[model samples]
Target: MASRLFKRPWTRSNDGSEATTASRPETPDDDDFHDAEEAVLHPDAHEEGGLAFNNRELLESQRSAIYELIRDMGMKFLTGHINLINMSLPVKMFEPRSYLEKLTDVWVYPALLTKAASCTDPVERMRWTVTWFVAGLQHVFQSWRKPFNPLLGETYQASQPDGSTVQMEQISHHPPISAFQITGPGYLFVGHSQPEVTFRANAIKTTAKGMRMLHFADGTSIDIVYPAYYMRGILSGTPRGEMVGTARFTDATHGLVCDVTFGKADGAAPSDRLLNRSDTCTATLCQLDRTNLASAQANSSASADASQERGWSKRLGGLTGRLTSLSLINRADNGLPEGSQVIGRGLGNWLSYFEWDHHRYWSIGESHATLWQPDPAALPSDCRFREDLVALRAGDVKQSQVLKEQLEVRQRQDAKLRKP
Candidate 1:
């Protein structure tokens, strides 16, 4: 009767920040971390997960009717193990953001990381690199809907607001791989990602492979790998997502490995309404402090165990950035007009790993904005300029489905004609 998933919470309005108060406790020592947090989270069920979409105590009281309709239509059968390229789903389920735009969000990194390639200190380099990677993640998991499948050979490009530009090419059709390149004044990036999926009765897992590669003018280089993700709350529960797996940034040139594992989920009890943080991992990373991280990384055996297990927290619903603490919160609108909404750092369902405090560490914000602009005159193969693309991105489900199928059919017909 209730929904069950997020993988991401709407932390705030897209416009601004929220005000802070003395609601949070003074920082706790490593041993007192869990006990401290337990005292802080609201005890009321309705006040849970910190709402951002609405001012009400609970996040938009979801209706069981949607699930009923989906069941009446046998939606589950079509949901599993199908090639998304050929499958069709309602567009209302997806975020309007495209994967290309998603890429640009993270590409804001090169600017933050240009100095990464030039720094001699491994820790400093890893620090900057990790920040770049994490910044792009704020909005990645906000919805359960999938992006419109870029037709085979469909491409996309962006000329950022900053002086940078990025290009992406959908290289394969069957397995669906996308390759991209970004060039700017001080940096260059080249990477490709291929997705492998596993569909479970109650969840869908999407694994993105081939870490990004970035180069600085000084010949410094590194490769980045994304954390694996899962769409949960399928069928009978709320739909949401969780960023699992260890994201890695390996600087072969600098002999450094920065691995960040999103921590475990924490609900009030063993059988709480929440159904997130997979069942595979054992350690609860929600409360890891810098001392604990340093202790873990300094101990050769613990570091090895971390690498071998590659598994961090399975609860707490926050992330443990290898050597840092990160606290995330979004602004909540107290039923105010959009213009009247007060902004601050705390509201919504915040995800913090305690590794990032504005005064503590990893706090250089806004260093990753891009300079280029979106180019309107994209080539025929570009996804942005594809016919009907605007409608697809605008969430017009029926129109997008028709266009998707038409393009696929056209490609097949042309292939048949090419057969000699």
Candidate 2:
């Protein structure tokens, strides 16, 4: 027999008394959860992406045991012999939310988009957008625990009171891919992401490759590519996460490009080693000559001669910032002429208030605006109502484990049936 997906007990009291609608705790309305005044931020953002973890000490012990097992199977874990993706850890190691829901962490500070859209200056607008891009990565630095994998076709949709809505759907199952779209006042963000995970002896690396595009009402758009991440010290030492490599942001409309280089906070001796102490980045913005680009493209298509190529771009000011503290300063080449470009500087943290060019951009505590909240009236197909995830959220580890296995089995059976 098929099992019921959503089994929340909001309709009845524990004593079997019928609960009044007003007395009953809010079930999923599929909209914003609380008023700005009543909104509460989770203590550990990773552990409680939406729902709190059941037991802290027990989970930590479980994690230590798992780590020891992985350490013992050093070669097996390091090599492709052990596929971590297919390996299921205890439900205690997973956050209740699905990967689709976890993606919403980026929108915790959605006001950044509004600032970018409203800005008149093209350079300043890109800066705001870049700030938002960096802000969105905050969650990745918090934790590396596993999240529930959404079933194919499962969806999650929510809208803020301001009419800004975000929707995510699990589009693929084999190599799980999530498709997302965010529509707000003056901008539309759409992307399809597929996470690539690999485990090494020393670290576990994760990279999500996707086509992320942010479009504004003014016909300007930005193309984004994220950096690679690594969770180091898996076998021994204290485990920590680091964002490595260069993340690219190209504003093709304005002929502007920003390449952010992430490094360790300790500015230690520069080595080819991937391990970094903390999350720090330097973003260099450059302006491409549109006329030169057009000419170069035309020439390239007309003839394959390299001698006919032209200079394509010139360096603009850049932002040297720390992701943890949310402080960035204008960094320009010493050789560049002064007063040639309007360089801006920003300092302070994003948690309280982030001041850019002496103006506050984000003040989470003081601001009355509520962060993104899931709606109770979401579609029946939403992942929020998924049996396994719901059980996990309620701290029913055994039930969740069974449900998760059942769901996986059903998915496998469906795939087999579909195959000719």
Candidate 3:
């Protein structure tokens, strides 16, 4: 069977931005508003000393007026077809359980809602849906940026059983500034702090023309460029752990490259220790571009929403689908090497709202560490052998004639023999 749902064609604006505003024209004047108010407040509006009838009458009047306005715009009634007015009315009447939940269910989650109702073309609908979802989410959540304290009442200075406090900041030239408590999946830390210091320096700014190198602050120097958003994720405790962050550095020509690396940070070492010493396990270098970042963020939001609604079966099927396509293309192009392992990491946890359940949290040791990799070679020779051994270790059986016979057979078997 074909898919039942579809996405609405997005209405694109002149400037290429997604257009989310309703197409319905506003009410002609204050006449409708005044009429509705009068209908509610009139003496006949009340019945049995209550204004229940009047309220209903007023609501009906308002609804009629809105419908009429929608009709005048050459569009169907506000409730006609799949317009914004129709989509929003149910949410207004019912009062969504949660704002985020409503957005997901009514707008973000339902791709078909837009596709089925949209007047625009499919390409436009896809583009507009993505833009609309991104803009709408940002508008709703960005304003609620109160400092989130995931670890309520958690102390920053945690004492281990040994009694030594985790040294958050070793000796640094920069004076310690503010500290905030943050908690992630596996680990919790009390006082996370960052210090900033400013030094006066001369710098040559980069332009489209060519490179201009400059220096200031005595020995301190930097090649000037547009500021970029920087992000870092760090894991640190008494025994060294992983830290990942974007770093800015220049080559011999003073061209800057932003390097993002994931690895362990040596707590014993100084703050300025070279990243290479800390086992630069994974690194990706992307040129600084705000537009690209914004686009990626938008796409990420859209994909995240879709991932949440997909069923387990569909998700698994999608994995096979992608693998088949890749295998075919790779074979034709001779792109991939022989015996290349397709290490597929499904976005299984993306369907969950809780960050702790996600792979990102698992990597950072936020919650319980989960086994991410399994070795097929580690399987026991016999399917029941591992379980039987475990059961024996758990005192399931003290002694058995069958177990003795199996051991004897194993000792004599050349295939099962191992060098001491």
RMSD of each: 14.4, 16.4, 30.4
| Tens-digit lDDT string for candidate 2 (205-234) | 887865567778998877777778776655
Please write out the lDDT profile of model 3 over residues 175-221, one tens digit for every residue.
21122221222222222222221111111111111111222112211
TM-score of 1: 0.58
Best by lDDT: 2
Ordering by TM-score: 2, 1, 3
Which segments of model 1 are wrong by more than 4 Å? Answer: 1-86, 90-98, 109-111, 115-120, 264-359, 363-373, 393-397, 415-420
lDDT of 1 at 195: 74
Point out the higher-scoring one by lDDT: 1 or 2: 2
Better of 1 and 3 by lDDT: 1
**How would you encode candidate 1's per-residue C-alpha lDDT over 1-420 as one tens digit per residue?**
132232222111223332232333344553332122211211121222321222222223222323443575475644656434345544544445455555555455455565555566655655665656654454445333456666666677777554567787665555566767777666677766677666556656777654366677766665666776665554443455555756655444433444454533443234432323231111111223344334433453443344435332121012111211110100011111122221111111212222222211222221224434566887766666665567766757578667756776887787687669
RMSD of 2: 16.4
Whole-model alpha-carbon lDDT for candidate 3: 0.23
Regions of candidate 3 where Cα sits further than 4 Å from its true position? 1-278, 285-322, 325-389, 392-420
Q: Least accurate stretch of 10 residues (summed lDDT) in model 1?
A: 325-334
